[model samples]
Target chain A: MITRRLPPWFVNALLVPLASVLCGFVVAGLVVAATGSDPIAAFSSLFQGAFTNQDAFAETLVSTTPYLFLGLGIALGFRAGLFNIGAEGQYYVGGLAGVFLAYSIHGVPGLIEIPLALAAGMLGGFVWSGIAGALKARFGAHEVITTIMLNYVAFLLANYLIDGGLMLAPHVSTPRTPEIDANAQLPIIIAGTRLHFGLILALVAVPLVWFLLQRTTLGFRLRSVGFNPTAARANGMSVGQTLVLSMGISGALAGLAGIVDILGVSHHMTDTVGAGYGFDAIAVALLARSNPWGVLPAALLFGALRNGASFMQLDTQVSSDLISVVQATVIIFVAAPVLVRWIFRLRRQQVAEVQITQREETAAV
Target chain B: MEFLSHQDVVGLLAQTLVTATPLTLAALGGIMCERSGVVNIALEGIMLTGAFVGYAVALATHNVWLGVLAAVVAGMLIATLHAALSVSLMVDQIVSGMVINILAVGITGVFYRNYIESSGLAGPDTLPHWNIPGLSALPVLGRIFFQNQFVTYAMLILIFAVHVVIFKTVWGLRTRACGENPAAAETAGINVYFVRYINVITSGALAGLGGAYFSLQQIGNFLPNMTGGRGFIALAAMIFGKWTPIGAFGASQLFAFSDALGSRLQIANVHIPIQFLGMLPYLVTIVVLAGAMGRAVAPAAVGKPYRRS
Candidate 1:
């Protein structure tokens, strides 16, 4: 009967977010009440909306795909001590690239067409993120600030493309690109469902990421640099190169998510295509504690929360934007773990201290 | 003929200078905080709050200076919370600054919805330009500077004062000391936290004034998120100018020039794609930030909280 110290594992994984979910629910409740809505009905509607039917499930899956991508991108960067805040921009550029490539080469063969579109998206992300990496390596530009500013630039560039050069659709009223041919689209998985093969790819990425981080030398180098770049440098690791490489990889993952969006969900590129996923991904990655394995549950939770918000609003008259509030609260809680751990640790410390004093008294006796 | 060309350029330059007034003020505030060891990324939010409060308060009181005073109070109040979190709790500077920004936006949005959505007070009385009579007659300079509103004059005074205080005063030296190396300064008996507190709050007040310039002086009403990333531009300017008040002001002028040029290009029908041209400031930020990498170094102990532990 190896009862092993399961407390550590449980506390780290389950308790923190479980506590946050509870707090989030309470905040949501207070918010609902503030708006003269019933919390119980709103919450019920939230749960019902998120899982009410197959269509809702499909929407959840659709939303989950980008979360998985951005989550993974952010997770990998955080693990490598590289804060890639530019994934939103990467997603934008990557989506743009896939659209540009798909439209640019229309007559490509069937088998290779989808792969080409995907690779283009990945390349788009790779090139965009590579700039930040190169700068961080060559010139020591702070990735955080540079990446953030680049988000605006990417947004602007996307505006440029959709409104001008890449305006494939004739109407062109909105800032979005033309839809690719049916062949370029991702094949739908379930019959009569909006769910696409992106879910399959995201799931596949989970294990692949786990393996890459755990089993490879590159992973070791990344982790070492993350822990202490100076030490990693002394040990012959090229910190700058690693920074750049990891950024490209991060961008590639985010870009792949964009490819999924083009071929799977929206089937076209638009100004509001990514829809704040990049910023939300930051919250998701941080809440998940930047763990790849941990991202699954975190993404699903956020997916459900986001998916249910519309119902919460429609049923209760509460602004569904309360979702943003809860999301932010969860991140704040996660960012400061010491605040949570201190409360629990206090009791344990008191008990242990008492035991030590008691044993000393007995010895004196 | 040469004199005419210079005069033409001076007229253009004078207009550019007039347009740059608000930017220079805000950018100056940005430098104050960045140099004093706080990022003050919420300069945009602080400016927005000041714009709304100043405009609304002045509109209610029928006094522009009172509105400006109200904006100062509002800005100081919000900055106090920023001070509490950053200086007292020692939270992540960027994260806290961003949170302040979001909160300011949220609060203002809510208030505007409540107060202005169905009300007439939303359209406030504009501040009249304070004419320096002789300066107003100085050909192109008169139209640009003297013909401008009071806020522009205030901004110029503030810029001069900032340059003097930053370069000449002992307090400024201590503030710079805190930003550069708080530990060594702390060892020398200067309270790092205290100096940072003053700087951050003062920085907040200056940013508030910048906001007043926007709503009270320019548009005359608080449109939602009117700062429109100008605060961030000011931030870029701070880095571009190598963290000096004057240098940052020059960067602000450059940004204001680009914005003016971008608008002019739209009007003049330049061949540059509208989207690409619209992206000028953001794109420039990326380029400037990329180039500023090694050249601009933040204060060594700027983000680190001073704890004995």
Candidate 2:
């Protein structure tokens, strides 16, 4: 019999992402060239801006913090077969709740106050996302539609609170809440940069999420439910409960992203706080193949692109929106691996099996 | 308090029709795609692409019709990409649609900022209102139906056309069969893939026309992400109507009426916060969706990619 060899797991893992990222750059380069800019010069500037100096590097890290948190949250949802598109709304609610608590509670010790504010943020996100989760669990409402609807509701609610003077700063004219208490503020880790303790928390969260998803019985049930809900229910797993718990945890993580943004970066909640991090985290999670451990690198790559976009714009007169193009192309390439495989002329073996299984599940439904 | 007047009511109804036109078109498009077994959440993106392309071409050619044509083509292009991914490549339909949305936004934003902004031109001319001769003279009906832009009339006609075609045509039956049970359709010797591709592409064209309405008719220019969440609302409308053309049109009218009423309330200096008024349509969508979930069953094969063994 002819022997067939499978590529090593590490090699296969790296190959797809690497090829897709390279394809993204290639497409982005074409777009840049079409716009009459030299792609090499623009990209070199991007690299220099992201990593060349201390301030730039710290800024990259600062951007990475939210992505890491949001990506982990989204990855968790994906693992549970839930699409939590409302992470943006959840982030907004979390920030609002954290700042609201920070403003209301006073004179508490720093040790007690900080965690309390953060917990409030998580509670806020949990409640917001829990609406969609509970609706999905109880009413059979699709999470995708409910989450998207909730996003608009969250925006309008935030707008109402800020503009209606409920949460507006006392002496400020802008649409923002008052600064949080000093005791609740996350300390800056790097002296001269915006880098703060939030990065440490984000880093710690990576392994924690990995452990939760890989090493725990709860994770097994969640994965089982995701793989086949009917089978999982037959096996005595409470699919509904698993969905609610996974979504709750996902919302909690996204809420932490909001709190981190407030405490470590903004120090106050603005209407635009945590602006696109929730959406960008979807890309981050996809790039990581929904693997919690892989989210760190994925988040870092996106953070660098976002951080360096301005430099690319300034140097090449190319609009920073090119990064969005790059990002979109990356997703397209990843989602349609057939295109990538065709372009690279790589042999596909186990990947086809995964696709077939996914199709079967859809068909079975 | 005499808060309402006859003229105001007439004007509001006219405004409601105008506002509902785009949504009606998009929802009908959504119905077509869903009936052919594809879940198209990318309607938002498709609409944006149409708006941007329509505006750009209209500006370049100084002809609104050409702009509309270009918008439809652009929409079809994106839809074709989505079809390739979701149908041919057998990718997850939702993820494919989401990527299409991101791609549309990125493409439109990049082109608008890099190419259009530097050109230093003003917005294109808006579409002219078309008043039917005899119908324009009717007492209440004229103001509600006759005095509107060309697109509003087209939308009404298209709604009737789609309803008739979907309910009365052999092709419609095949398309619905593909969605309800593709395997059965295949066994009956129907070309499921071809039927789906045609319906989906046509759906894109219709959504593109809706996008063109925003630029060429409604606002006369495209803004970044001008479609906002209307596409999602249209999806909600589609579901609310149980994926029927006339049903979706009715749902669209209800949403558009609420939207028009909200703006009218704001203009009337109502004491309620404007944001709360702004929240009305989305709130209604959630309530409607939640209330209709168990009762509204989607086409059985929707969101599934059919692969021949």
Candidate 3:
């Protein structure tokens, strides 16, 4: 009766993630209390920093841009049943390539330069992740292990290239690449704010990904392979090819995330440009349940947390790392729906049973 | 290259074992958990928690042995969460592990910043090196094998112990049964859930000991993310070794040799860049997984939750 009363969509899309986030807050609040901090005060400051303070919301949007792109990337991978944890490495590689491309060209128009740099970035990410995909398809290698390994490799490679290497800019104290041409730099949409055009690109990417997953033939094939590779193969679909393409596309989005951060925010690629955005994006994608549209809100939540963390630290003397606790708990609750349901005292839905009975009755009729 | 003496080579080999100890421990942990049908990507997180808890306790109590104990207990506690989520609640194993990893980072970072960083407390000393009496007198072999810290000795012992236990014990057979075919294992009157829980917890204990290698044995201070992706490298070693304890040890040694070689080359002022040297272990792991050796397969029922009808 309870299952019949509430719509499945309400229970799933809204109730679950919302309840999980609430649970995450409760868990993190308990941690704050244990650490002798005022949980309520910390949370208030966090909210204020994320929303109400001057330029805070814009900064939050700036933070949200990377999460949005990376979240979409990870979500796309999850749809293909690929656990691509190499986003951090792919991000570094993408940023490196994009920055190199951006700085190499001179006198090019902004319109032409931006897309080319973006493409270079995406291509870099694709190549990095595509190696793992190829290995998996060729030798049955697990993507999880390969991607994680590649992440370290990417970091080292980035470090090598940026520090006293070819990418290091002249007359700069820091170890980083040269700044992109002014034309290549993303224009700030808001006056006197750090927020740039990448936010628009990120926003547009949501529906584009949704359309690709929902309406496109490639999306259907990818999902089918993810659902059951054996069945997909039996149905004459190239499972290997799908896996490779899915990983490449996923990596390209992560690459886009990296390049956008460089062009729009940093204006140059540094070895430390990753700053855990790729890892945080995993939490984002998991929070979204790998749904493209769901990624928007999930990314924003993470963005708000990241943007507000420093303010919370300043106000309550709580460490900014407290956000990670909240993130960890949120992911835990999101992953284990059964645990969430039990905690919330929600009944299991009978949708499958209802559908089964309807099918049987129709057959008899 | 001319500066690389025989003594230097011996020292490098000795250092290689020391570097390999933690990897071998964590890889053994991976072998244990995965052998019992639980995927534990949380080894990195558990090891980090262990290192933090170990250091914190030692700083408070001034007893390194107690610190080691605390680390193991902390790891077990974290793994208990993993078991609860993945085993009892039937959550996706990878997601649960990732949660634990992230949680460890947050918890450790917060505690380190608030208590340790602000207090400016001096950390307890590193674990005492044990020089074996007669064996340490032997020229090259003795120093390489005998002169080491407590964790290194324990790691060598554990490598053999895990091999014997996993291959020779009845419990190990039951654990393998659960991993290979949990439904059949359940039908055979083996408690699949119980086996999984115990193995996963045991794996946590192993990874916890590995965590002590950093804080108690080597560094004498806990740093955030100091485990430095060793947990993932251990996972690769587990897969590369095909989930065997000895094989994991061998793979760990190979990775460790590369790490040690990099440092040795740096000391000798080799032309190779430092970044490339730092990258050796990760690159080797990728190469190993690409099947340059051979195909490595996992247990059939591993990473799947069992349901009884």
Residue by residue across B1-309, what tens digits does model 3's lDDT show? 676789888988898899998899999999999999888899999999999999999999999999999999998999999999888877778777888999999999888877887878789989998999999989998989999988899999999998887899999899899988899999999998899999999999999999999999998999988998899878877877889999999888888888888777777778688777666667666666666666566787777777777
Clash counts for all predictions: 0, 0, 0
CAPRI level of candidate 2:
medium
**Residue-wise lDDT of candidate 2 within A1-365, one digit each (tens)?**
11124453533466667777899899989987877778899889888878895599899999899999999999888888888888999998888898898878888886898888889989988988888777776666677777877888888888888777899988886888888788878999989899999999999999999999999999998788777878988999997788788888888899989988898888887775336778878888887888898898899999999999888778767777788778888877776777766776656662432221222232211
Question: For model 2, how does the per-residue alpha-carbon lDDT over B1-309 read when each residue is reduced to its tens digit?
Answer: 245698888888888888888888889888888898988888988999999999999999999889989988888888888888888888778777888787887778777877788888887889888889999999989999998887788889999888877778988899999999999999999899898888888888989999999999988988888888788878878877778888888888888887888778877887677777666666666666566444566788888889987
Who wins the DockQ comparison? Answer: 3
lDDT of 1 by residue, B161-236 (tens): 9888877999888888887778788898899888888888888888888889888888778786777767777777
* DockQ for candidate 3: 0.55
Interface RMSD of each: 12.8, 3.5, 9.4
lDDT of 1 by residue, A235-347 (tens): 99998888788888889888988888888878888776337678678767776777788888888877887788777667755555566657755654554444445544523
Error of 1 at A20 (Å): 3.9
Provide candidate 1's TM-score on chain A. 0.90
- Ranking of models by TM-score: 3, 2, 1
Question: Could you tell me how far off, in angstroms, the CA of residue A135 lies in candidate 3 after the best superposition?
Answer: 1.8
- TM-score, cand. 3: 0.96
What's the CA error at residue B258 for candidate 3, in Å? 1.4
Best by lDDT: 3
Clashes of 3: 0
- Candidate order by lDDT, highest to lowest? 3, 2, 1
lDDT of 3 by residue, A99-163 (tens): 99999899999999999999999999999999988877776667777788888888888888888
- TM-score for each prediction? 0.86, 0.95, 0.96
Off by over 4 Å in 3: A1-4, A350-365
